[model samples]
Target: MRLLAWWSRRMLSAALTLLLISLLIFAASRLMPGGFAEVVLGPFASAEEKAEVSAKYGLDRGILTQYWLWLSSAVHGDFGLSMITREPVTTEFGLRLPVTAELTILGMAAAIVFGVPLGVLTAIRAGRRGGGALGRLASGFGVSVPEFVLGSLVVFLFSRYALGLTVGGYVPFGTDPAANLRAMVLPAAVLSVFVIAVTARTTRDAVLTVLVEPYIAAAVARGESPGSIVRRHVLRNASIPVITVLGTVTAYLLGGAVIVEYLFNLPGIGSYVVQAVGRRDYAVVQAGVLLAAVVFVVMTTLTDAVAGVLDPRFGRSA
Candidate 1:
């Protein structure tokens, strides 16, 4: 029952957070410099067309009323129609969101693949006398380099290997999974480099601390292999920090997707949002912001659930 209570509280907090986020997105969209009418129709549209479009989306209503109506429509699965396409915003999002989602997944997987073992190794060495020069250098590079710079470096390397060809663009996985992976691999790897550093450094410290506990020493004294001890005892205790880094990394990578998408001209939601914002397309902007916000919330919630499953001490019921 206590665990159930905790779950309920966490879920309620998530809901409230998302609601607040949605409200903020709505307000922010409304405040985008000029009126939506100017942005959507441009100056070429006749006064009559502007009036029709305005009335169509309830822009004739006050900002607050329009927000309420839009929010209600959102709750009912109508994400509003695209002002630019006259098609449903949901359809546009449906097509684009998947690519962004896939890119995010690839980035995260790269992060975990590279981060975990380095973190463990660094932590183990630190427990002895702190990471030596090589470890220090690796960590420094990971922490210091920004994504854009790192991405450029990666592209440079790929360009050499690609032999005058390029590979930073987005290709649909459904159309050709191999090409899609090829295009995304370098960008995803670059995106994850920061996260890898953070996770490794944090895990190293946390595991080193856990190693000093009596149980760890006791296990060592009993002839448990160093590898086994680190894998089971040290890592289990060290996992929370690693998971925290992963959660944060996932969010950052999603945002970073915009940069990658822009560079690659991928039709993912991130790039879509960027283009829409450039054109000041209100519906696309609103949908993209709301969707990204939802993704962030959902990822955090999933992190919590995964942590709960992996580590029961938090007393998570679900």
Candidate 2:
């Protein structure tokens, strides 16, 4: 009953948050610098044509009314027509979502596989020479370099070396699995770097905190094996914080994906929104951002749920 109640509250909170985000997305899309009518009709369009265009799209409606209409359509999974593409925004999003989803999954998997282990190593060898430097280097690099720059550097290095790898173009996995996987590799790798750095740093801090607990010292005094102690105690206790960080990072990746997709020429939502913004395709922009927000909210909620499961202390608060 307690868990059920907790989940119910969580769902309500998520719904309310999403509602607020949708409103913001609508307002921002509507307020974008250039008038959508002018963009769609071009600069040479007559004033009468622009006015007709605006009225046709209901852009002349008050913002609140426009939001209600957009929200209504969106609730039915109808995101309206793209001003530029003339196709349904939802349809375009559907086509691109899988590409971004696969990329994010691959990147996250790599981040966890590499980051956790590196963090653990750094934590265990905290005072030792060379051990601490690796964590610092990764975190510093991630913080200092913009993802676009990193992506460009990665593309240039791989392309220059001709290491039997493809650089930019994306192939549908259904059409050619091998080629698709090859195309996805560079982008996923690029996306994973910042995640990896973040995960490693977070894990190191969490593990270090766990190591100093009285129970850990007690385990050490009792002649427990180092491996056993770390596996059973250190990791178990450290995981909650790492999980929180991973969840936040996962949400961030959804947004960060745009830059990577553009750099790699992948047809993901990130790149979709970029094109929409360029064309002032309000429908596409609004829907894409709303989708990203939904994903972000979902990830954070799931994170809280998982953390509650792992640490009963969280459940009390829930």
Candidate 3:
């Protein structure tokens, strides 16, 4: 019952947050410098033509009325027509969302696979003299490099010189699974860098704290193996913070994917958004922003639920 109540509260908060975000997205879209009518009709278009275009699209309506109409349509899975493409915004978003989602998922998976182990190993080694240096160095390097810079470097080194890997294109997995994976690798790796840094640092800190806990000492005194103690106590406790970091990192990846996708020439929602914004395609922009917000909220909520399961105190407290 308490769990249900907690989830209901979370859902309500998420809905309200999304509503606020939608309002901001709408306002920001309106604030874009170019008039949508001029973009669609060209600069040579007569004032009469521009006026007709604006009125045709309800652009002349009051902001609140426009929002109400758009929001109403959006609730029914209609995001209206893109001024640039003349195609349904929903259709475009639907086509692009999966690619971004795949990239995000792969990046998160790679980060967890690499970062968590490295963090655990580093924490264990830190107990010995002078062992934490390598972890610190790695985390520093990861944090220092920006995603776009790293992505460019990867393209330069791998695509241009050494590996001769393909650069700046995407193949649909349905069409060519092997090619798709190959194409996704670099962008996903670029996306994972900050995730790896954050997860490793957070995990290292959490594990280090757990290592000195009374339960850990008790386990060690009872002749428990290091692996067993880690599995039983250290990892369990450390996971809470690591999971939180993972959730945060995943949310960050959604935004970071924009640059990475543009650099890599991937046809994901990130690139879609970039193009839409450039063309002042307000419907596309609004839909993209709302979708991104929904994904972030859902991912974070699930992370919290998972944490609650792992540590009953969280569940009970709620």
| Each prediction's TM-score versus the true structure | 0.87, 0.95, 0.94
Candidate 3's C-alpha runs over 4 A off are: 42-46, 254-256, 316-318
Relative to the true structure, candidate 1 reaches a TM of: 0.87
Model 1 lDDT at residue 209: 82
Top candidate on lDDT is 2
lDDT of candidate 3 over 1-318, digit per residue (tens): 888899999999888998899899999999888789878888899999999989988899999999999988887888899877789987887788778888889978977898898899889999689898898789879988898899888888877675745676688889998888888888888888888887898899999999999988999999999999989898989999899888877876664388889888899888898888878889888988887787788878888999999998987775
Q: Which stretches of candidate 2 lie over 4 Å from their true place?
A: none
lDDT of 2 at 229: 96
* Better-scoring candidate (TM-score), 1 or 3: 3
Model 2 agreement with the true structure over 1-318: per-residue lDDT tens digits: 888898899999999999999988888887778888877788899999998988988888888898898899999989999887788887887888789888889988987899999889889988787768867787768757888999999889988897877898789899999999999998998888888888888899999999999999999999999899999999989998899889988887775498899888898988889888888888888888888888889989999989998898897796
- The C-alpha lDDT values of all candidates are 0.75, 0.87, 0.86
Candidate 1 runs further than 4 Å off: 40-53, 127-130, 153-165, 254-256, 316-318
The local distance difference test score of model 3 is 0.86
Worst 10 residues of 1 by lDDT: 127-136
Error of 1 at 29 (Å): 0.9
